[model samples]
Each structure stands twice: as C-alpha cells, then as structure tokens.
Target: MDNSLAELDARVSGCRACPRLVDWREEVARTKRAAFADWTYWGRPVPGFGPPDASLLVIGLAPAAHGGNRTGRMFTGDRSGDVLYAALHEVGLASQPTSLSVDDGLTLYGVRVTSPVHCAPPDNKPTPWERDTCRPWLVTELKLLRPTLRAVVVLGAFGWQAALPAFAEAGWTVPRPRPAFSHGARIALESPTNNPLELFGCFHVSQRNTFTRRLTPEMLRNVLRTAAEAAGLPTRPYAG
Candidate 1:
C-alpha cells in the first residue's frame, strides 16, 4: 500500500484498468466539445483534489465528460461543480466559489474532493464492472487519509454505495445490512483499528437536481456545515 497520498494519486492518474473507460475518455478528449475546442483535455483519470490531511472528504460519482475529463481536475469546469463549490464556499470549506480550471486559484480548506470512477464514462454512467475495478483506488485513498479524516459527505446514491465498502476496507466498520442512502442521511461508523468516522449523504449537484430545486444551494450548504462541524472543522456563517 502506498503510504503517501501523492504517490497514490500519481498511480491513479495513469491507470488504464478499465478499457471501456479508457476508450471513452480518450475519445471525448479527441473529439473536444465545441465550447472547449481550444482547451487541451486532460483525458487521463482525474485524481482527488485537496490537501492530504483533510478532515472532511466529499465523494462524487464520477467526472463529467466535458468537465473533469476536460480540465483534469475533479468537478472543475462543470455545472455540478458550480453548485458544489459554491456551497462549500458558503459553508467556508472552499476558498472561492468557482472552480473553472485546476489553476483557477480555488482551494478546498480541510476538505478533499474525489470520485469512485476517476475517468469519465459514456453517457455519464460507469459500468458496474468499471466501478468495481476502480474501487481499490478509493480504498487506498481512504486508507491514506486515515490519520486525520473524520467525516465524509457522499453526493448521490451511487457515491454513497461506493463509499461504504471503501470505508470498510479502509478500517471503518460498516453496520450490517448496509445503510440505505437518502439525502441528508448521517451515519456514525466505528472502527477497532482506526478512528471513528461520520458519513453523510446528499443529492448530487447535477443540473437535473439543481434546476428542479431538488438540491438548492441552502440545502447543500446545510449538509456541508453539519459535516464540517462533525469533522471538527470550523465553518464561517453563510455570508448570504
């Protein structure tokens, strides 16, 4: 097992374990989106973004074909990111409200953002096989984060499902008959060999949810504030 997050991330970024994901990501990169025609796509797997010692971790489903796959940074250059980052900023977990590019000067404070499937999938849905194949990366990441990690906010059911097993593998004992996912759900987990951790669920920041008000900015900020507090991190009051 890699002892450092940097080494684990380097290995993750170059992974080609899932051929379907590999082909799809590369194809999208080559056939660049019209709006991002001048951009050089970071077609490889998108690694987690934030400091290694983060106490709070936010897990998403996967990278968007034109978002992370284009920018090489998870959640960057996408509508989902706009909602997520803005909420994080409002809750004082992020330094800024925007995440346009990797160099956009946006920094996550005491939080890290990652996804189960690093590469972008076709139609924004990764296959079960691909998610399983990509599981070890998350497991390793969780283990690497064990020292200071305390709370996790899983966005959407897919991420919620993916995260539980990884948490188990990383030393947190998941309850029997695994917990069902629901927005605003919070579960406390204990580990004999590791620190106790809290898990939270929220609706994804996808456009469908945001446009319909299924996940309003205030709703997202509520979850972040609760999670950040649970993780022992201080959060600023919502400026708005």
Candidate 2:
C-alpha cells in the first residue's frame, strides 16, 4: 500500500467524525454481536478497496448493514457486492467472481471502489455532517489517483453528488442539462491537467434494486462495458 492509502486506512480505523453515527453503529454491532461475534468491528471509517494505481474509481453512497460494516472492505460480504463483483469480473476490472470477505483473494485489476461515508450509518443513511467530514478523504484519494484515473462510475445519486464537486475543483465543468443517474448515462469532463475523465452513472446494485428489477445485471453490465469502451479498454460480453 502507498503511504497515502496507509494514512487513509489509519484515519478510517479511528474516525469519530460523527459521534452520533459512531454510537449508533457500535450499538447495532453490539446488538448483533451473537451473529457476528467473530467479526472485527472496524467501528470507525471504511476505506477504498483495490490497488492505488487503478484507472477506474467506483464511488458508492455508504456501507451496508452487514456488508462493508462487518467485512471492513467497501462492498464486501453483501448482496450488492455480489452483483457488483460479478459485473466487475465481466468487465475485466476484477479478478474474482465475488466479494464476500476481506480475505477472499479478490483483486481489482484497474478499478477501485469506495464510499463517501466509510461507516455504516443507521438505516444506511448518513447525516450531512458525517458526509461533509468525510469528503476530504475522497478528495485526497482522487488527487492521489488522478494520474491513473480514466473513468469514475458512480453507483447512485449520492455518489454522483459527492464526486462531482471534486471534478469541478479539478477544473471540470458540468455539462448542460447535467448528467442524470440512469443505468447507462455518460458524462465527460476534463481534469485540471486536461486529461479526460469519463463519468458513468448507474443505479446501485442493491437488493432493493435487483430484487425489484429496478436495475438488472444486464443493465449494470452495459454501463460498465460503456465505461470500459470510453476508457479505451476492450469490452467483454457478460458470461451469464
């Protein structure tokens, strides 16, 4: 791990940006202690997953109840991660079929995934203060990863909103009418260095979305395929 990432990991492991959230998450973990007794409660913040030199960054809203909160890796040990890793594998971004745990031997080839709020908020909803406190980490990560970043795929509206300001700070203007969060909408912007950073918006692959057929595997795969294409990477067909 790079020094920056190491610093981020340390910060996340001891974050107390929001005392209410901290208390709430700990309470939830304690109540479910019997179920997850063996699990280590990060109980602080959650950091990004995958290599530091990745070309793609996947931004999500926050950690899930039993997913990232328990597993300590963003998008791990959850239903949403199941669909996400599957799509990542199909798009040649990940080296594994699924992400169930931190030590699952999963690896992202050219991509990384992270959430704006690292800790699991009560009811999966983070407060504005918590989001504000955590925004700097995302900005720092973007700056560190900018050299290699070619595309950023936001999982939902929250992710899009949190990430857009950073792009603007980097001198990227938002396009007219704005880019909406559909399954396959694409937005293009130039970084301060004049490198193009393609932004693709997709509905989150949450249980609510997938189980309700709001976002299907095919639709998610198509968004990733388009992102890969925009980044000048060859797209692979979805195996399923």
Candidate 3:
C-alpha cells in the first residue's frame, strides 16, 4: 500500500471520535454477523480510495448499509454506488468495469470518492454531532490531497454542508456571496493558501431520486463533465 493509503487505513481503523458510530457499527456487525460473518468490519473511519494525486474529489454523505459498510469502500456494492461507478467508468475516471468490493481491483485515475461520515449511519442518516466528530479527518485528508485537488463535486446537499468547513479552512471563501447547492450549480474559490478549489453540486444517485426521476444518469454525467472541464480535465462527449 502507498504511504498515504497506509496512513488512511490506520486512521480509519483507530478512529474513535464518535463513540455512538463505533457502537452502532459494532452492533450492526454483531447482529448481522451471520450475513457478514466472513467480512472484517473496518468499524472505524472510512477513507477515500484513489491515487493520492487525484485532481477531483467526490464527497458523499455517508456509506450505504450494504455498500461501503460491507465492502470497505465508499460507494461499493449498492444501487447508488452502481450508478456512481458506472458514471465514473463512462467518463474514464475508473479503471475497472465496476466497483463491487475492495478486491475487485477497481481504481480511479484523476478522481477519488469519500464521505463525511465514514461509517454507515442508522437509517442512512447521521446526527450533527457525528458529522462534527468526523470533520477533522476530512480536514486532514483535504490538506494531504491539496497538491492535486482542483475540484470537488458534492453528491448531495448534506455532502455540501459537510464539505463547506474544509473549503473554508483552506481559505476558500464561498465566493463573496455563499454558493448554494442547486443541481448543476458551480462555484469557484481560492483556498487560504491561494490554491484554487472549484465546486459542483448534484443530487445524489439514490434509489428515490432514480425511481422518482429526480436524477438521471445523463444529468449526473453532464454535471461531472462540466466539473471536469472547469478543473482543466478533458471532458468526455455527452453520450445522451
């Protein structure tokens, strides 16, 4: 493993910032042991997966119950993740065909995916306190990734909120007037250190969004392509 990945793994394995999340994950692991008996629960914090020098960072809300919680990778083995990885692959960000598990040999090129709350929350919702507790890890990760990070794509409103502080800490003001979360909205800011950070917002690829037609694969692809272009990446032609 790379040094950054090793450090991330250690931090995630030893994370105890939120006792409730720790306990909750343990309970879920124990109760659902028969189902995931052979799986080793990271049970601590979850970290981003991709090259350390990735230019794009995709921030998500939290892990899905059977997705990252089980596969030990954010956005893996779940419906939402399916759409996400498919889009990533379509855009040439992903190396493998799909993201099913850690052992699936999947990799990201210029992008990486992470979440505000590392562990899977109950009912897929995390309390404000839990979000706060996990903020520092996000901060550290951003700092470590600052060298190559040029753009951040927040998957949902919640993710936008969770990522705001990190941008602020990096000295990126919300563009004089705050940048709000609206589908297809884009914002640009300079970090405190004067590093540029471009941001894009999009509705999550949840089942409800898909079933209700609130978010379509075409729309998500467009948003990503726009973000990539803004970040100085080669944009893929829109397939839709």
Candidate 4:
C-alpha cells in the first residue's frame, strides 16, 4: 500500500481489526453520554487531524470514549483537548485554542495529532494485542512524515512505549537502552533518510494532571514551544 495520508485515514477509520474495541466504541456511541445525549457519535476509529506535511507529530494514547468517539476528532469535546489545544495556540501552532467539533475551525500550523490506538478502548486502555494490530497504521504514518518530521511529542507512557518501536520500524535509530518516560524527557534519534528525529515526553493532559498541577499550562506550553522551535518551525510572530 502507498499509504498516503488520505488512504491511511480512510483505511484506519473503517478498521474493525479489534473486536473488543469495536464493540466498546459502538456501545458507547449508542448508549451516549448524558451530556452528549443528542449528539450523533463517531463510533468508528478516528484519523489524524492535521496537515499532511506536518513536521511535529503528537501521539496520544487513544480517543477518549465520549471525546473523540463522539466528536469524530482527536481530543475534541473534552477537557484534555481543552488543555492541549490551548497550549498549541499559545505557541502559535494552532489557529484557535479550542477544538469543539471536527469543523470548528481549529487548525494546526505544522503539527499532527494521532494516537497509538484509533478506537476508544474499554476503560481507557487497549490490550497489547490491540495496539500491535494497530501499529502498522502508525508505522505508515511515520514513514510518510519522516522526511519533514523533526520531532514527536508523546502524551503519556503508553504513547512513549508505542511510538519508539514504530519509529524504529520506519528506520529511525532508537537508543538501545530505552529512555524512561518523564515530563520533558528527550531523546535524539538518527533517521536513516532524513534529519535526526527528536522524541519528547510529557504527562498526559487529563483533568487529573491539570487540576492537580502535575501538568500545568505553563509546563505543557513550554515543552511544545521548545519542541516546535527545535523542529525548525517558524517562530510565532510577536511571541513576547
């Protein structure tokens, strides 16, 4: 498969590879959250929502059941998206700070947001088998993006664990002794065909982290800004 972004997206969104995930996502959509009862949910897998030539890729764990599964976009209609996009906007990567819907006019300048698992998993977790089954999609995405992809920002430990191998499969040299996942953790890898790819780790933007101050707005913004600048993206005009 050529695996162009469009091809990958269409293929990914239609996948029924994991029966457990399929059942859970559709069930949630059918039952519907009380807050989003009237909403028509997106029970299928969600695709990456960003430009095709993005230089920075953001990998999250998976769609929040009612969040992406309902809104048909990564991190949309949720508090986590609230924190993440606000940081992107602060750093000038996003045109707006909020992503309420798929067509809400929020745009990323040079960044792409995706996940290891496309479907919302039961209990916010996907089994190892499910992740492996979905790995090829991510591998294809990295292969297509590597020419311009300078950095990858991992939202949580699951993404950190999931991404390193996919990147290696795409021919990036991950360190032999894997680096631990911590806020601000960074590793520079030599890509076989492109410039070195940098890896960054950050605590997930879950409400628990933000409300408890484990991941503050400033901290998230600083890491994203630093990574974007390192990726050789144009500086935001008038950033004081």
Candidate 5:
C-alpha cells in the first residue's frame, strides 16, 4: 500500500468495517436533518483535512452526524467547528474563522485536523469496539505524517485515549501507563528517527464544553499556540 496521505485518505473514505457506524451514517444521510434537508450529506467516512506536510495535528473524537458527515470535511458545518476554526484563525493557524463546507476555501497553515474514528457514530459517540476497529486508519495516518509531524493537540479524553496507542504504533515512544488526559496537560514523546513529539491535551470544542465555559476561547488558543510553538511553527500575536 502507498504511504502517501492521499492514498491513505482514499482508503479511509471507503472503509466499511464497522457495520453499525456505516448504517448510522448512511441512515442519517438518507433521513437528513431538517436544517440541512436540501443539502446532500456526505454519508461516507470523513478524512483528515490539511496539507500533507503539516507540523501539528489536532485530534478529535469523531465527526458529528450532520457536521463533517454532511459537508464531507472534518469539522465543517457545525457549531463545534465554529468554535475551533475561530480559535485557529485567531492564532494564525487557520486561514479563516469559519468552516461551513468543503468548498469554503478554509486552510490550515501548518496544522492538520483529524479524528480517531472516521465515520459519524450515533449520539456523537462510538463504541469501544468500534474505536479499536477504527484504530488502524489513524495509525496509518500518523505514520504518513510522522516525517514532519512534531506536535499533537488531542481534544477530549476519548481522543486522548485513542491517540496515545496510535502514536506508539506510528513509532513514537509512549510512556508506560500512558499519560492521562486533562486540559493543558503536556507530555514529551521520543522517537528514534524523528525529533521528539510534543503532545498537549485540550477539552473537546463541543457545545457542551464551550457553552458551559469549561473550555473558553482563551484556553483553546493558549493550548493551540503552545503546541504550534512546540511544533516550530510561527503563530500570529494573540488578539486577546
């Protein structure tokens, strides 16, 4: 199999390993949300979005049922994306503050956004078995990105837990017992052939977190900037 990102992404989009997830995503696409009734939903699995040579990677749990699953792009057409892209734009990592669709022309400077699970799961959650089953795709992505990848920002504990093992499989030396996930948590992972990878933890940009103020814009930007710097990528001055 080719190790190219494009090749891996094509394979990701075609995956039908999880029967439940495949059925759920397709069913959601067929039923269509009332708000998006006129739009064609991207019922297939979602792939990572960004340049192939990105230095920093943002890992989330999974695509939202009507968000990425509808727009065919990670984090597109959703409130969570609104919060995330805004912060990324403020910090100069993203070209725009909004990501409404795949053709919106939004771009990431030196950061890539992906999730452990590609398919949208029911209630925005995937079962443990589904997560494990989907792990190989993420591991392959990590391996392809390893050449220039230097830092990772994992959103939420689910992503954090899912990413560590992938990082290890992709060649980073994860510490024993694995580092626990918490907002603002940082850990250094060693690699035999590459520079050490800096890992940072942040709360998921879900509405539940942002609306409740558990994860503020400032907090999100702070983590992003720190990880960007660690990745050796320049960022714009903080707006606030």
Candidate 6:
C-alpha cells in the first residue's frame, strides 16, 4: 500500500462507527465457520486494498461473512473471490488468479478494490442507513485518489449506487439524472480540475450469479479489460 493508502487503511480498519455491524461481525468471528474452526477471523472492518496511485478502482458490496471476514481481505476465501480474481488475473490486472489470503502474493497493477460498506452485514446486505454512514470514508479515499483515479469498475448495482454519491460528495460534476445500473452500464463523470472518471457496471461476482451463469468469466473479463484499457493501462491480458 502507498503511504496515504496505508494511513487510510489503518483508520478504516479501526472504524467502529456502526454498533450493529460491530456486534454482528464480532459474533460471526466468534462462532467461526465449521470448516474454518481453527482459523482466526478478522472480525473488524476490512479496509480497501491496492496502491494509492491506481488509475482504476473496483468497488464491491461488503465483505462476505465467511470469505473476507475469515480471510481479512476483500474477495478472499470465497467462491466469489475465486471467480473475480481469476478474471482479474486473465485481464493482467492481478499478479495471480488466486486470492485465498492476505499474504497470497497477489498484487494489483493499476487497480484498487474497496467497498461501500466496509463491514460484513447479515444476509450480505447492509441497511441504507449504514451505507450512508460509511460514505465519508469512500469520499475521503476518492479525494486522495483523484489525481490518478480514471475509471471505476463497480461490481454490482449496490456498488454503483454507493459510488455515485461519493463522487458527487468529492465535488465531481455528476450527471443530473443518475444512470441506471446494468450488466454493461457505462457513464462518465466530469471533474472541474481533473480528468473525467469513467464508471463501468458488471454483475456482482457472487455464487448466486456465477453458479447460475448469470455472470461468466468472459462477461467480467470483458468489462475489466475495457476498464483497464480506458485507464490507459496495457491491454495484453492473458487468456489463462
């Protein structure tokens, strides 16, 4: 992580603003999944990971209860992560296709992954109020990344919805009428002093979607490659 990102990560990790989230995340950690009974869970908020100077940002929904909550990293230790990281690897954004743990030696070249709600919510859904409360962190993080942040690939409608407001809060000129989210949704937000920020939408990489083929690796990788290219990154993504 970059120095500024490290500072933000530290603060995000220690956040306990939402009492309900705090209680629930800790309770899940305490219970421990049967398969991960011997593993120590990262019950606290999972901070966003990636370099601060990244040009592309990947915003997800919250961490998975057993996946990220267990592995202490976004999209790690879960079926969803398996699909996501594989697509990222194929697109040349990630160093490896597997992100099973925080120390897994996986590095993102020009992308950062984060979320609207940092904590793992019950039923994988965070209440609207909770979403609003956590908006400041996203807004601040965006402020820091404004220099190089060029594109944002939102994993789902939830991420799309959450990000629009943060961009507006960070003083970007948002479109008057918000664009609706779709599998291949795309929009551009203009900034007064910085380059325009492109936003792309894709279905969430959840088991519900992947298992049913609602979201395939091809679909996700296409969007990722497009976003990476739009950000001026190399486009020679591997087929692996």
Backbone clashes under 3 angstroms, per model: 0, 0, 2, 0, 0, 0
Q: Please report, as a residue range, the 10-residue window in candidate 6 with the lowest summed lDDT.
A: 231-240
Query: Which number leads on lDDT?
Result: 5
True-vs-predicted CA distance for residue 113, candidate 6, Å: 0.3
Order the candidate numbers by lDDT, best to worst: 5, 1, 4, 6, 2, 3
Residue 137 in candidate 5, Cα distance off native in Å: 0.8
Off by over 4 Å in 2: 1-3, 176-178
Clashing pairs in 4: none
For candidate 3, lDDT tens digit of each residue in 6-75? Answer: 5975676567777777777767666664666777665545667877887888999988766777777888
Give the distance in Å from residue 69's predicted Cα in candidate 3 to where it truly belongs. 1.1
Give the distance in Å from residue 66's predicted Cα in candidate 2 to where it truly belongs: 1.5
lDDT of prediction 2: 0.79
Summarize candidate 4's per-residue lDDT along 141-217 as a digit string, tens digits.
Answer: 98888778898899989999998899888888889898879999989999658679889999999888999999999
lDDT of each residue in 119-174, candidate 2, tens digit only: 88888788778887887778777777777788888998877877777666555677
In terms of lDDT, model 4 sits at 0.91
RMSD of each: 0.7, 2.3, 2.6, 1.4, 0.8, 1.8
lDDT values for all models: 0.94, 0.79, 0.79, 0.91, 0.94, 0.90
Candidate 3 Cα errors over 4 Å, as ranges: 1-5, 33-41
| TM-score to native of every candidate shown | 0.99, 0.91, 0.91, 0.96, 0.98, 0.96
* Candidate 5 lDDT over residue span 9-128, tens digit each: 899999999999999999999999999999999999999999999999999999999999999999999999999999999999999999999998998998999999999999988999
Model 4 vs. true fold: TM: 0.96
Clashes of 6: 0
Residue runs of model 5 more than 4 Å from their true location after superposition: none
- What is candidate 3's CA lDDT for residue 131? 89
On TM-score, the stronger of 2 and 4 is: 4
Model 6, 1-240: lDDT tens digits are 234878888898999999999999999999988999999999989988888899999999999999888888988999988998888888888899999999989999988999999999999989999999999889988888988999989988888899899999887888878888999988888987867898899999998999999998899999999999889888654546
